[model samples]
Target chain A: MSIEARFRIDRDDFTLDVDLTIPERGVTALFGPSGCGKTTLLRAIAGLEASQNGYLKVGDEIWQDEQKNLLPHQRPIGYVFQEPSLFAHLNVQRNLEYGLKRLRGVTPKVSLKHAVELLGIGHLLERKPHQLSGGEQQRVAIARALAVSPAMLLMDEPLAALDMIRKHEILPYLESLHRELDIPVLYVSHSREEVARLGDNLVLLEAGRVQAMGTVSELFSRLDLALAHGPETETVIKAVVAGYDEEFELSYLDFSGGRFAVAGKRLPLGSAARLQILARDISLTLEHQTKTSILNIFPATVDEMTYEGTAQITVKIKIGSVAVLVRITRKSASELGLQLGQAVYAQVKSVALLS
Target chain B: MFTEYDLAALWITLKLAVITTLILLLIGTPLAWWLARSRWRYKFLFEAVVALPLVLPPTVLGFYLLIALGPHGPIGGLMETLGGSPLAFTFTGLVIGSVFYSMPFVVQPLQGAFTAIGERPLEVAATLGASPIDRFFSVAVPLARPGFLTATVLGFAHTLGEFGVVLMIGGNIPGVTQVLSIAIYDHVEALEYTQAHWISGSLLLLSFLLLMSVYALNRRFSVVKP
Candidate 1:
């Protein structure tokens, strides 16, 4: 099943036109720059934006069509705003219960106790919103949304308002949600790191248009899209924990491409983890070098190459079925004679295993 | 030490003010809510109309209201056709006048509070399955508590001290239409300084206390920042 949407919203400064079908499971990130209509698209799907000539359907349910439009409250969707937006007149417990108590005989997919435990907000139940930190309030907001047992979750840059430390504090809860929940999530963000770590599908938006939509690895490794050209370009690969070495503190991660040895992390064997490989952190060589300090190296064949500005070239190389990105200086690329279809070795300096 | 006339005036004034304040609240709440949330370009015109009493002369308002409520005018003609006497000099007529006079004091604060609540909280409530009406009662009313207190006190106090509107519409009918403000004016007119002092002093102290409690309570509630 998929959530299909077609919307056209015209504003004074910008217009949003989008039509696509997003998978009805996992997190599909609406990634874009500011003023790119990410939030507008999210609002449209939630029925909060009154856009003319719009159509939206979640699975078999028609939320909005030419004949009728569902109001925001009528849609069985949970929304997490950029800010916490906790009700000031309500205590933390009542705020969480606001949505739960409104459930009109719909079998709840997420219970209040489950949501409270999921977000680790048990102790703050009796406190008010102002008494909690920015991160804690957001957790409560998320738990409140979850407590409604929504069919789909809409998050518009939920971490955008928090500082670095606060963002770090909340990312784990979000990760747990991604891992544990089965609900479809339409997550909107401009940060590549967050998307690379969490997104199962990526919708690249620019100037109110859908530039591209594909799996996270497919989009991030494409040399043509801006996602691969940005300074934050990264390759995300789904890998499983193979084994751990206690002597030297290293963990073995097995992906479709190959196995990688990374700095030791406490992870259960055979559990899936996301490995983020930044383009800049990867270097290329003509041959598989032995005795190199780099611990993660795999044989790859060049799929495509594009010039990034005048100084560097971005190469998309396929390792088995998975594609990885490598950024090299023009002079070095010319020296190595890197070309499409040429087989090479990619040395990854670091692999960030996002648990 | 107060005479029967003074006591009657005190009771009549309290009744008028209380009735006027209640009616204003009942009618002003919806009007103010509409003014705050409407996106029409001419929404400010409605706001200006509601706030007109704040600056317009009470006698000018009373003059127009007198014409409208008199037996010959449109409203009075309708009342006459309905087999009712003219409203111009009745206690009901005074309430209608006070509601007009105290309109802004009640509406302006309610409008400000509703506006300050903004669209986010309402949207959040909607996403939480709160219908618009549900959101208003559960989210908006509670959040705008400070503004309601301000509106109620200001409306009541302002109505208690009304002179021109009541005098213009409700001719000084003792035990019926005679209110504190009119009684004080009558006392001074008759050179009865001591009688005027008692009514005027009580009105002054009552208004001051009402206004003071509003300010003090508003300060305490402002710390909540709903």
Candidate 2:
């Protein structure tokens, strides 16, 4: 099943008009800068924005259409706002039960105990909201939403209100939730690192419009998209832990592109992991260098090339079935006479391991 | 030094304050919720009308209410047509006058409390499967507890001390319409200083205790909020 949404919202300064069909099982990120209407689109899908002429379908259920409009409470959706928004009058346990009590006769798919344990808030059940720190309060807010057993979850910049330290404190819980839950998630965020780490499908929004939509790996490496040429531009790759070299303390991850030797033995064999390879860390060579210290060297075919300003050039290359980006100086490109479809070797410096 | 009439007047005053406070809470809740949440451009006009009793002289409000409740006026005329006697100079007339007189005392505090809550809690409640009515009772009411205490005390105390409105609409009947304030007036007019001092002192003490409890309770409640 998939979610189909069509919304047209007109405001004084901006308008959001889009049609999207995203997968219903994994996290689909509405990625954009501030004021680009990513949050508005999420709110519209949740039935909070009151956008007219909108049509929304989650799985087989029609949440909104021309003839009928469900209110926010009527839609079976769990929403996490930018703030924790825990009820000040209630203790943490009562706050968690607030939604569970309203479920009427519907059988709860997510039990209250499971939500509490998932967020690691079991010890805070007796304390009031004022007693908890910012990160703890946000955890309670998330658990409260989950206790309702909603069909889908919508999060609007959930980490934007916290500092870097607090964000780190809560991200693990979020990652585990993504791993364990079957409910689909619509995550709205402007942070590129967050999108790269948590998102499975990416919906790129620009100026209140859908610029592009695809799997995270495809969009991140696409040369024409805005994600390709920036200093922070990186390609995401899905890999499986092949083996661990206990002597060198290295874990070998095999992807469609090639095998990567990363500096860790933490990942268990046969587990899945994500890798982020920055474009600047990669250098193109005409032949394999045997005298080099670099451990990762893979033969790739150049698929596309684009100039960055006057000095640097970004080249897209295909290694087996996966696409990766490599940035080299324009002088090097000209001296080597690099052209599209040319066979080359891509040298890697480092990679970030994401789970 | 208090007479039997003074005791009777005290009963009538307490009865009026209690009934008026209850009525104000029932109606003032929805009114204050609207004032706090509505984005209507002309809302200030309605707010100004609720606050008129605060600035206007009590006698001026009493005069208009006296006219409105009299036998020939609109409200009294409607009652007469419905086969009931006119409300002027009755205990019910005193109640109507007190509700109008003490409106701002109840509504302003409630509206301020509701506004201070912000919209985040209610929206969170909605996402958690609370209907509008359910949200009001479950979230809004509990969060606005301090406001409810303030509104109740202010409305009841303000009604107890009313003199001009009661004199005009209630006509100061001995056992029926005469309240503590009018009774104290009668004692002072007859040069009965002891009886007047006794009643006035009781009122002063009662109002002080009510106000003190609200401040004490409000501070405790404020600590629970972030």
Interface RMSD for each predicted structure: 1.2, 0.7
- TM-scores of all predicted structures: 0.98, 0.98
Model 2 vs. true fold: TM: 0.98
Most accurate candidate by DockQ: 2
Q: What ranges in model 1 sit over 4 Å off?
A: none
Q: Give fnat of each prediction, in order.
A: 0.76, 0.80
Please give, for residues A1-355, the per-residue lDDT of candidate 2 as tens digits.
Answer: 9999999999999999999998998789999889999989998988889787999998998999999899989889899999999999999999999989988898999999999999999999999999999999999999998989999989988899999999999888888888889989999999888888888999999998999999999999999988887799898999999998888988899998789999854787888788998999999899998899898899999999999879999999999989998888999999989999999999998888887
Alpha-carbon local distance difference test for all models: 0.93, 0.92
Which of the CAPRI classes, incorrect, acceptable, medium or high, describes model 1?
Answer: medium
Residues A1-355, candidate 1, lDDT per residue (tens digit)? 9999999999999999999999998999999999999999999998899999899989998989989899999999899999999999899999999998888999899989999999999999999888999999999999999999999999999999999999999999999999999999999999988998789999999999999999998888887787889687889999999999998889899999889998957699998898999899999998898989999989999998888899999889999989998988999999998888999999999999998
Clashes of 2: 0
